[model samples]
Target chain A: MPTVTLSLGKDSYDVHVMNGALDRLGDLVHRSRLTGHAAIVTDTTVVRHYGERARLALEEAGYTTSLHVVDAGEQSKSLATVETLASELVKAGVDRSGFIVALGGGVVGDLAGFTASIHYRGIPFVQVPTTIMAQVDSSVGGKTAVNIPAGKNLVGSFHQPRLVVVDPLTLTTLPARVIREGMAEMVKHAAIRDAAMLYDIRALAEETELGFTLSTIERLPDLIARNIAIKARVVEEDEKETKDVRAFLNFGHTLGHGIEAAVPYGELLHGEVVSLGMRAALFLSEKYAGLSAHASEDVLSTLKALELPLVLPEGIDPATALEKTLTDKKFQAGMIRFVLLGALGQPTISDDITIDDLKEALALLQRPA
Target chain B: MPTVTLSLGKDSYDVHVMNGALDRLGDLVHRSRLTGHAAIVTDTTVVRHYGERARLALEEAGYTTSLHVVDAGEQSKSLATVETLASELVKAGVDRSGFIVALGGGVVGDLAGFTASIHYRGIPFVQVPTTIMAQVDSSVGGKTAVNIPAGKNLVGSFHQPRLVVVDPLTLTTLPARVIREGMAEMVKHAAIRDAAMLYDIRALAEETELGFTLSTIERLPDLIARNIAIKARVVEEDEKETKDVRAFLNFGHTLGHGIEAAVPYGELLHGEVVSLGMRAALFLSEKYAGLSAHASEDVLSTLKALELPLVLPEGIDPATALEKTLTDKKFQAGMIRFVLLGALGQPTISDDITIDDLKEALALLQRPA
Candidate 1:
């Protein structure tokens, strides 16, 4: 598959998606014009799978490497983890010229990318996302962060990575639920910017149902690249999330992040909550953005085909979710800038999203259609 | 006094150096176009002195204000303080639209500016520097940081402030030693960029001896503004410290910071060490950069006029200091990249400095010329 280049002038970088790209990670990163030492920040679980391969590839390419593995869970995404990783990198003699390789899912990517952002007042880093969610969303943009007690990603910088290498082969090792998490972001991309990509996503969903090996699917790499292209375009338009164009990427995240926080930490994964959030947003889109009911159904059905949840979970409270949106980072200055679609593939940020409208949206998510 | 506008295109900001600016800090910041709430992050000492005045000014300017005070001194420049400040801001309803007023010296500026940099992925911050060290140096460049156990300023970002309000009146409360700490940087700026500024510094030193009130001197504001202008010009050339142009500002810091770590904290003030370091750098400048001995003597005489030490301390180990330089952030890729001077005001970066030369410089500092 061809590489997707995210154009941000001086901060521009490429996202490479291929079947066997993981083994060629060093060469791709080298092509990005980074040299010298490489700090490979991965989690224990991922280190067991591909750590040696990654280190060996970099070492072979004349780049010295050190592997620093954290615990394999969301628990490791904290300021403490960042401090520990920074100490380890310093101990390993990593300097300003060195680059970090975030070689895991979103947790490792966020942790390592953020570490790179502050280490020596910012250094270069490459993203080698091993999960679908990270491959399609987190690794493509410059948003690197760790969860704080206040909220997720509250302490971070917009530090763009030097490169991104996505290997579809890594998805074969993931469970169905994890794969579905990444599909949620893909569906978001289709809903926000590319209605035509929904057709490709639906076809991929069918291939999953047919039990085809994920890496063997002919269009898997291309589909990931397409999602990255959408992300790249949005980021290019507004790299700092200052403009509404980038805020449109929060199509499902505004309510989704709120619902995620309202519940217990591990009760629901990020993408699952986003799936539910998307349903509520679809309802709002029809009412507010003049989105057609048929267009909303097409997106909902596509999400359904990917085995994502459309209804709110039983233990979650609608009132708590609505209140939590007020604390969401997207909740700017008491205004819930809700992202509504004019149609499938057309997103618009709504400044008039009242608390009552949010209540109505959350209330609609209580039961199936 | 007129404002010194440090122009870096979109990141340009004015450095106001009037004696009474602190009383009008809110108006200055408001002129910078920051609105909503203002979180004034100060220290216990500064708050006791001017916190109420600052708060009242901002409130009078139509900004709801909150005061968050940390323990005074450098011990508070830690990651723990950052985490605490972040939670406090979140609790105080300080959001993206709100700005932070760093209302003390370098410590408060760094802590609050760093907090602002990461708060909501960064927000506008105004610098209300109460000490000469901050007003002339730290506040102008937007180099915000907190010290780590590994190194001072090891983790930080180059988040520029929207405005810097430098009230020279604050220097009235500082002891002579505290005043001299800032003078070291003044001397450094003069040595690196403005040789004529040395004459003004010598005159200021005479005024300090002749019992003139610190804030009553007519040229005080212009002196501060001149230092800021030099710093602003260097930062404009290399905002991220990516070029050697910015490194020239570190003319005395290479050995100065290392020597600082070699000794116990608080034993020798920052400028004292830099004064000693400047003497050593002068030796090297004469040896390698062909800086005339007359020019070197001119700088040494200024340090003498300011009562800055030109000799190493009794207890500090030169070897340990040299070893600490290896860990300095400027020690990139095993090269020293020491900033040198070809003349009084012409600085250059030399990558050819060897360890033996550094040893000789340390040795030179062991005795007074």
Candidate 2:
């Protein structure tokens, strides 16, 4: 097992990555001293797959486990879902000393984490991420939130999890498309802070089974450990994302969140939108951030080879998309700031772009004739 | 002007108290470096009285001010109120950099503070508390929340305002009953942490005008300053009430919140509920935590003299009222912990009581035959 600690003073917690670590959950929970009733928040898909195993593990560990299965999609990431989960927690008698274990993908992680954040003014929670997307990204950061009607993640809190148990073996049952979607975020982390990891991921993408094989799962522990370490380092220094160090983590998210907002959630997974947004951001970077043409080409090639979306979805108007960007929470002082790539392993925030420039970038993302 | 600083690391802000300082709001905003479009969230009662003055303050401060008025009452401290305020904020194009000024009593402070906390993943806000209850307690604690159907302050965050401007002159137009409501919270603060202040308040409550004369207002800055200091000390140590240091601030809030949750809000102001709750807690403290009989009598005499409620409302079943205390957010391990008075200046939390014990305490609070 590879262990990485996120230093947030008294709110600090550890992220442990290991294949088949789910069996050791009982020990981890024991060591953390979180006792009493445990509420496991997962989704329909996850409950259908490994929910029983997780329940058995917690039961064997001497916890009274209750399951709260939410609808399994991006739509589940809403205040309504958070309310439902909080109500369930209250009904289940989960209190300050009780534990909330989020056992699903990013949607479940975000929703459950947020529910824990506000329930009874906040409670302790553990993140048992069952998807690659969650293990690599959402579970490591304490940025928990629920989407509001006005914007995605517009309602939430920075409530850190007590522990993150990343069991790579859980990803075995994930659909191929889901695996591809998860890789886009990993690719984003690499593009922003780790060039060597990007090179390795690009090489791994060409293999048969698209890097979801058992051997690939073994490599995942290390990859996730490294990605989580990078995120931990950034978040530790700036937990609330106020500083530049934390802002680098939003490499592809400025436009990515806008894209996700423009489209109906569940139609496109967050990583899929992020994949295309990364390409648009790269183009903007090349034009306005003084990035070399080769770097932009490298980004496009990696995204394409991974089978992720590199262009805007059909029927999305450039003007409409540009307008959405302006309204994004990332906008400040009437300027839409973009996290641009200066080079591999480097990211910069820029707001000096004209609407015409963004329009041209969006136009370029249209599907080829 | 008496200025007190709330040192919350990077989130530190100033609490400015002065007579006629509402006119100096322009310079204060400039000092805080908050610019751009601003939204003033106040109730109709306040708008009808001090709206133009607050507007001129922001306008002279170089901010384009937009007003959002809600109904004036504790009933407005609901999620529906928050949603309405949020919609108004969105409609007014209050973006990330925009400032939200909560101007009114505790109701406006809670509603507006919560709206700012959730709007766009949190925005900077200034609390211009126009009521005594607000300046001394709600405005300083960083505990902003909206009541839910399930509980009071069931949904909210610890989003601290960038500045708290308390103009004692604002109290000049406040109704006598409203002034008394504010005094309850002030007395609660003193009873929890400062014996000297409690003694002083006891003396002040006996005077004509309930100590609201110009000399009293001149003495106001220091009294409000001391009450706020007590709260600020507790909050500074534990911003999230996870420890005993922070729970001390909840001295009268356990049963107080239950009463507020049971009654239709606005029927009994927060201070009224807190007053009754404080009496109940004192009886419990005398029985369980070694509170002296003479001290208890002094507490009753002071509250009765202030005309604050010292007994439970008529027809309220003690058992039913006790049930609400069980669901209080402060419960841990199925035990409802409460902050009880050890003496006039000392407060302590105890979980070593039964529902029957609370019922017994409640019986003591029954109306005298």
Candidate 3:
């Protein structure tokens, strides 16, 4: 197991990147002695694909396993769903001593982890993430939340999982678009913190073996591991986002979340918005952070070659999308803190980013109707 | 200002026991500098009594204050209420940078604490306890939760407050019944951890000074502080109750929660059931822990003199009440773990109590109605 140890004192845990890692979840859980009763929470689509495998792994490890399924989109990441899942867990005899396994993508992970966080004033939970977005991004962080009607992740808690089992093999079944969209996060990781990693990822994107399909990429496990390591380092430095360092991880999320919220929640994938957000950030970087024209060109070319959309999809109004950013959790006192690229790898936080700057940046992402 | 420090490392905080602590809550909250946006979560009844006072204090402290009121009683402690409050907080423009104040007794404290634990994955919160029960017990622990239709506190999280402001002045307006019901917990605390405290409480019970009216208590702040200290010692030893030391604090809660839930939720004040629960535990103590008959009589006399209940209410069934204990959160791997008293001041954990013993003990609490 190539594990990335994310240390947050008592809340620390390992993010294990191993092929077929889901099969070994039983061993990891048993080693930790988390619980004999396991509640596996997954989305409807994921349950059909990985449910039995997950159940078998835990049951063989002497766990009394039960499956709880939610719908397979962002809408399922909600309080009502959490309430229903909790009631089902109670019915399945999952007590305070029982451990919860979030066995899918970010939606399932967020909802299940949030459920476990409050199920009995908190219980042990593990993230068996199946998507690249979740593996390298959401799973390693202790941030768990559900979308309220007012905003995304408006209500939740800082409950860390006991362990994270990242099995890249699970992503093999995902559609190509989902996989490609998830890579946007990896791109953002490189842009914000690691210049060398960005060049490396761009080089890999030029290689023939790096086809968009999961079957074509044997190099993904290593790529994902590097991204997780970068994220793990940042999270270890600031788990609760109190020191503004963790705010670095929210590099593209300000406008990214805004765009995601502006459209129908499930319309454009989360990473797609971030991809558009990154493209817009490059414009902001040039205008505000003294990013070079040559460097911005290189970044745009890399994103284009990787097939990530560089602008908002048709029908999205730039102004409406800009309005959505106002409610961003990043808004403090009254100003929205924007994280812009100072250079290729240097991300800078600016509280002085006016709404006019946001509009100007979003204009670059507006596709003609 | 008299302060009792309840230290649990990162979770530790001071319990300020002052005669007019509520008036200075702004100073304490501001001193900690937890957050500037204050969302005060109180009940309708509470807001009417101290709502203006609370609002003025925080407002004067320069906090942007928003008041969210829930109807009084146990029913208000639900996920629906949490959802509504969260939405209200959002509407009030509370961001993660805000702090929350829980300004009521057990119901408001539990609901508000729970709201804080999950709202924006938790923000800083302060507890301004108004009732004797909350001051002596619930407000000290970080256990925040809501009632699911399945059970009381079946869903929650462990989010400790930055400060617990206990103003004895708030108790002056509490109904006499609420005050007596509260004494049950103080009696239970004395019985389990401190014999001298128990004797002192017994002496207090015999005095004319211990009247059913709230205005009669001239020496309550010290008595309340002593009980909080006993609880503080137990909670410090085990913040999450993993080591079972804190479970000792639940000496009478096994059957107590059952009685509360089996009847109408609002019908039995929590401490009233716990009072009867303490009476039943004494019977079990005699049969299983070799507790002296004289000691049991002394405990009973103390409870009776304090106006706490010794038997189940007129309508609750003995069998139904016993069944509710089966779902106790203290149950691990299907066995209900009971905290019983070995003597007046010796509380110990017991896993060997059979159903026969529980039935026999509970039978003692049956009224002849």
Best by TM-score: 1
Clashes of 2: 0
What TM-score did chain B of candidate 3 earn?
0.95
Residue pair clashes in candidate 1: none
Winning model by DockQ: 3
Per-model TM values vs. the true structure: 0.97, 0.92, 0.95
Candidate 1 DockQ score? 0.70
Chain B TM-score, one value per candidate, order as shown: 0.98, 0.94, 0.95
How is the predicted docking of candidate 2 categorized under the CAPRI scheme?
Answer: acceptable
lDDT of 3 by residue, B300-329 (tens): 887787778787777779888888887777
Which of the predicted structures, 1 or 3, would earn the higher lDDT when compared with the native?
1
lDDT of 2 by residue, A5-117 (tens): 98888888889998888888877877778888889999999998878888888888899989999998878887667666776777788766677999999989998988787
Greater DockQ among 1 and 2 belongs to 1
Flag the better candidate by DockQ, 1 or 3.
Answer: 3
lDDT of each: 0.88, 0.81, 0.83
TM-score of 2: 0.92
- Write one digit per residue (lDDT tens) for candidate 1, span B1-369: 768888888988988888788888878778878888999999999998899999998988889999999999998887788888888888888878888999998889998988888887888899999988898899988888877767788778888999888888888878887887789999999999899989989988877865556444567888888898999899988898877898898888999988988989888888888898888899998899999999999999999998988877798799999999778878988888888999988999998789999999999888877
Instruction: Name the 10 consecutive residues with the lowest summed lDDT in model 3 chain B.
Output: B208-217
